[model samples]
Target: MQSNDGPAIDETSSSSSSSSSSSSSSFSSFSSSSVTVTITKLTTNKRKSMLTVNGYEFHFKDYNKAKTIKFLRCASRNCGILLHKSFSDEFVRFSGKMTDHSHLPNTAALGIRTLREKLRQRAEHERLPLQEIAEQEVRAGLLTGHNLLHNRRKLMPPLPQSCDFNIPDEYRKDYLNRDRLLLHDSYDPQFQLHESVYKRPEGRTLVWSSDVQLKLLFDSEKLYMDGTFCTAPPNFNQVYIIQVIHHETFKLYLFH
Candidate 1:
């Protein structure tokens, strides 16, 4: 009888210990899951600039989670100025106008409506049917073709000077005599100046390349060049020439 009684007491103690351990573990899990941090606004003694525009004063407020402080403007319609609470503390004490509580149309209200309309238009445009795009594209192409033909005829009028067959001897002579120096001295001086400047800088070198070389290399790599601009010379009215050399084959390519 005494041995049986000892075993029963031991079993009861073990059950109580296990239950206490389980309850502690459950409480710890609950405590961790329920834990949350709340941020509250705190008043600071720092004074900031307050702008009073139209009849309203705006104030800057300190927020705990914000990187930069936010400004709170007066809710008055006529006065849209921002007031600093620290700076406006004295003003608020005497002026009954501090809390006028009037609803005036401010810049914020104006901008809010405009932004909403813009967003709505953007959403509507995004939802447009593909058929509308196809129709617009077709119309644009037809209009562009018509404008091009009309401009070409107007620009290229029938005149003695307009004919490409006629070449003036004076113009030809002027072209040949324009480059009497044979080589451009400006190129060497500019290159030498840049090289000298870069030599003093660590891990730097002065390099120059033309658009033609850039285009050729891009094409060889199956890439395309974009954002190209073409301008005609005053007298010649022709595109500028660009030259490129192939890296592997050493072949020259010219583009205009």
Candidate 2:
């Protein structure tokens, strides 16, 4: 009877220990699920990628290429939250701990950031005029002021520093049709330029007019000449504009 009673006591103690261990394991899993981090990807003003978690934004601080992980830090000032994101699989997975934020999230700033990103993306891919695009975005965002948010020069070619730079072949012709827009290029003889409109050797003058415009100028009975001194290029004293009057409507059109 003593031996049977001892076996029963040992069995009860073992079951209790097993139950405690299972409860601990379940609690651990529940805690992990409760604080599961969800990451939201976004773009910075410079079009760089960033992530947001729990209304806080994080930017990349470092990268671990071999481990396929990205280390990020809170964008807010003095915020100590750090994140480790794993990119080894098809989806991004979050790791490590994040502390409580020092201040509340600024939803206005976040909205502005999102607005700027949208403006930049529209500027990049769309063929619509910039003014039209900006107006549409401004109305959609309910933003004030007429200032454009995106960089205007993003799609434009870099301006040449000096007159000695080479002109690209595409720029030499009209964009609508492949017609010669550059009538003369004195510096570069390879262009097979026309004779200079002004014969002065010291103050060399360049003129641009299509063949059709020249024909119209010759056919018109009345011609108008206007010269602008203030708007001329730095090297020139004045810019002369020749105009022709339409026969039927009497409207003036630029001839040169």
Per-candidate TM-scores read 0.17, 0.38
The numbered model that scores best in TM-score is: 2
64-178 per-residue lDDT for model 2 (tens digits)? 5454556666776487665555552121323324355655665566666666667777888999998998899888877344434335446556766554566676656554335
The sequence of per-residue lDDT tens digits that candidate 1 reaches over residues 12-67 is 11110000000000011111122221111211113223333332333343321332
Rate residue 81 of model 1 by lDDT: 38
Off by over 4 Å in 2: 1-32, 64-66, 88-98, 143-256
The pairs that clash in candidate 2 are none
> How many pairs of residues collide in each model?
13, 0
Best by lDDT: 2
Q: Give the CA lDDT, 0 to 100, for residue 126 in model 2.
A: 99
